[model samples]
Target chain A: MRIIRYSEAINEALHQLLASNKKVFLIGQGVTSPWYVGTTTVGLIDRFGPHRVFDTPVSENAVTGLGVGAALTGMRPIVVHPRMDFMYYAMDQIANQAANWHYMFGGQMSVPITIWGIINRGGEQGAQHSQALQAIFAHIPGLKVVMPSTPYDVKGLLVASVEDDNPVIFIDDRWLYNYEGDVPEELYSIKIGKGIVRRKGKDVTIVATSYMVYKAIEAGKDLEKEGVDVEIIDLRTVKPMDKQLLYNSVKKTKRLVIADASWKTCGIGAEISATIAESKLLTTLKAPIIRITLPDAPAPASSVLEQAYYPESKDIVLAVENLLKYSCDNNEKCDY
Target chain B: MYKKKSVNTDIPLKTLREMYLTMLRIRKFEETVASLILKKEIQTPCHLYIGQEAIATGVCTSLRKSDYVFSTHRSHGHYIAKGGDLKKLMAELYCRETGCSYGRGGSMHIADPDIGLPGSSAIVAGTIPLAVGVAYSFFLQKKDNVSVAFFGDGAVGEGVFYESLNLAALKKLPVLFVCENNLFSTHMPISACLANIDIKKTAETFCIPTARVDGNDVQSVYKTAKKMIENARKNKGPAFIECMTYRWYGHVGPNLDIDKGLRSKEELDYWMKRDPIKKLERQMIQQKILTIAKKKVIEEMIKKEIDEAIAFKNKSHSPEKIDIARSVFKEE
Candidate 1:
């Protein structure tokens, strides 16, 4: 295993994919530039040449459609949307064309394409720049949405996405690019719809994704001191969620708290909460499910307020503590 | 203006007959669709290609089955000319389950991948970039196939058109951008809307070889399309062809009313004198290659085929409401 930053891990996966497959190519704005905003695509053009790793005009919609068209014609295209917020401009191409081409064509075509968007609640980047809209894409039926919180998972999941026959929306949190984790040195891939158990406990199950996964791990460590053991599930793939793993964990613990960085309303947290409620686990719950997410509003511009707006380890812990207090006050016992 | 070049009388009579058959098919299909719309049988807005059949027929005749073609909103002529099944197209327009797109795509989005006519988008200039991408794929695969994007003069103002042209030229991809300059974009004339009405000059700015032809003349349009497609197949890169044409009906449906008073009666009469279908028939008769009785027999045969297609569409089922959510994603 090699310790590397999340961005480096992604770069390694891309380089490996390109080296292995001659049909694979990359296109996006500023992709061939020296500055490389995310630093994940560095040295790609130098190695692959401009024909394969090239820069497209600022026309996001056209470029995205071009990627989809190329993918349909037997090419594996990896399109980079510099910032996730700018994806709105190309939503028609992504949602209507790339996502629906295969099924719409009666399974006669396959779009082996990967769209990587740098997203997260970036500090001080006001309302427009700092949106975690993974839930919006997850709601779409034809798309595969994945967000990896660790460098190891990023590399494995990215390789899997590139190899997948369907279009995969691989979102990378800008805040996690510099975060370091141990990744394998050999070529490997993680399954598309599996979750990793970060920490195992019996009291409460905390399901998290992306940046929230890190916070959940930290909160699990802190809660161990108070004897409130927590089971943390890092949901790597948001769309084809690991419902079996989550349901099994929740069935055992009989308590749940979801931590997501996106807005609370209609968010992934809400979907997970609803899923648990609608399942047989509803009767097994000792207390109502809790969700810790960003406030229901555009992220504020102020740095201090922005920090307050995003969910953190403290928020997860507080939500867990509240659920526990409610169970105790109601004289309920954990039942499975 | 340059002197009119003598007609290529040496071309085989069989090729001219095929072109005539294609145009007649498109014209008959549009007429049938217009009648259906008027009878309240087909509900969707129908864009008739009554006068512009020559453009679709002539351009598509030069393309191969492996080559790709993209079309705009006024796409019925394109669909039929590109060898789309009349029964399936009629079924699609009627929202039948057996339609080309399973009734999901109506008149504006008829697509048949088996013949390499992937699909037509309602968005103006939307398929320009897509055509370039398809051309790029052929280039990457080292194939001789060329991709054609058919749009109208209205699409020239779209930024995507310019961007796609530049990219195709820079990459030297095998693409033929066919602009059917039908003089109007949904009732607005080109002169009133565009600052520069010259499409060939604009294409030349991107260093792409270009040609301008009378879209109403089937032979002229077919010859130009043939040359451009041949050049592209030879790895000579992209070319742009501006086919000057006109739509005989309203922008959306079958109506003779010329809105905005942009088209004069005299101009319409002058173009009618150069009707492609009549011109081809006259040439065929004068050369003693086709008799009037033979032409009648061909028309009657086409009418019967169209009637059977209409019956097939009428008997087809409508898509179920539950199937709406099925084709949005690939499950496996």
Candidate 2:
């Protein structure tokens, strides 16, 4: 195992895919520019030549349609969106065309394309430049969304997405780029819709996605010093979520807190909370479910405002402490 | 001004007969669909290719079986011309299990990738960039295959149209953009939409070779499409051909728009006098290629085909309730 940054893991995965398969090619606005896509696309153009690693003009919708079109003709294409916010311009091609092609055609055709959308938040990028809009793509039926947090999962999930015989939305956060983790050099894939327990405990169950997984782990350590045990589950894939795993963890802990780097309403947290509510697990919960997410407003640019706008590990600790306080104050029997 | 090509003594008699047969099939199939819509047999909205048969027949004739053709909401003519199964298309319109799309796609969404017609969509300019992508695939593979995008004049208003053109030109990919300029975008005239109604000139701005032809004249459209498609197959970049035609029916169903006051009767008559099928029939007869008896025999053959397709549609079953969620994702 080699310790590699999250962005390097992604770059290595693309390199292996292109080398292994001649049908795989990369296309987007700034694939050649590291400043736009980070080091994830580094050295791709030099190794594969220009035909395979194509840097396209700034035509988001057309470029996306180009990917879908090539997929129709049996080419595996990876179309990258430098910023997740501007991907809305390609909504018709993504939602109406790529999402519905397989189903509408009665499974006669398979669109084996990967849409790589990088989430850029903070750095005072403002609302348009900074967004984690996985919820929007996750809402569509035919699309499969995966948000890998660690370096290991990032490389594995990307390979799985490219090989899968459907359009997979691979979302990543720029904040997680520099973080390093152990990744196998060999090409392998982690099963989608599977979650892993980052840190195991029995007090409170924390379900975090993508970048928030690290924050949740940080909070878990801080809570450990205060004698509050926290269990963190890294939800690798969001669409076909591992409901069984979540149910078992929540059943053990009897307390649940969902941390996602998106807005609160109709977000991934809401989906998970609603799923638990509908399941038999509703009876297993000891307190109301809490969600740590961005407030219901656009992200601001000011440094002070940015500090308050985004949630951190401290917020998770506070939420867990508040839940424990409510449990002890209201009930005669307190597990904590 | 677009130069009009004269009737060449070069086209084979058999090819002329085949083009005539294709146009008649489209006209008769749409006419049958009009009656079917009135009879409440087809429940989905259909954009009929009534008077615009020549463009599809002419362009498709120039293409090989391996060449890809992406079409628009008005797609029956393109499908039939590209050798899509008539019974399957009819079954799809009726939303039957044995349909081409297994009842999932109606008139607006039809596909047959086996014959290089990957798919068609209702969204204007939806499949334009897709054709360019397919062309790019061929270019990357060093193949001589060409991809054609058949859209209406309304699609020219979309930004992706120019974007696709620019990409095709930038890559020098082999693609043909066929614009069936039928003079109306739904109920509005092209004049109301485009400040500059020159569709070919718009494509020319991308440095692509452009051609304008009379869509009612099958010979003109065929000659132009063949030249452009041949040029594309040589990997000489993309070409655009704007075929001037008109639709007899309304934007969607069977009813003519004349009663709705969307178009004047005088304008409709002017195009009606230039009916592609009638014009081809006249040319074929004057050339002693089609006698009245032969024409009657051909008409009966097409009528029987449409009848058999309708019967197949009536006999097929609807998709089962248990399989409602099937095919949403390709089962691995």
Compute the lDDT of residue A138 as modeled in candidate 2: 92
Q: Highest DockQ, which number?
A: 2
Regions more than 4 Å wrong, model 2 = A329-336, B1-7
Q: TM-score of model 1 relative to the true fold?
A: 0.91
Write down the worst ten-residue block by lDDT for model 2 chain A: A327-336
Pairs that clash in candidate 2: none
- Cα lDDT of model 1 overall? 0.85
Q: Candidate 1 residues A12-31, lDDT tens each? A: 99889888998888888888
> What RMSD does each model have against the real structure?
4.0, 3.0
DockQ of each: 0.44, 0.80
Q: Best by TM-score, which number?
A: 2
Supply the TM-score of chain A against the true chain A for every candidate structure: 0.96, 0.97
DockQ score of the complex predicted as candidate 1: 0.44
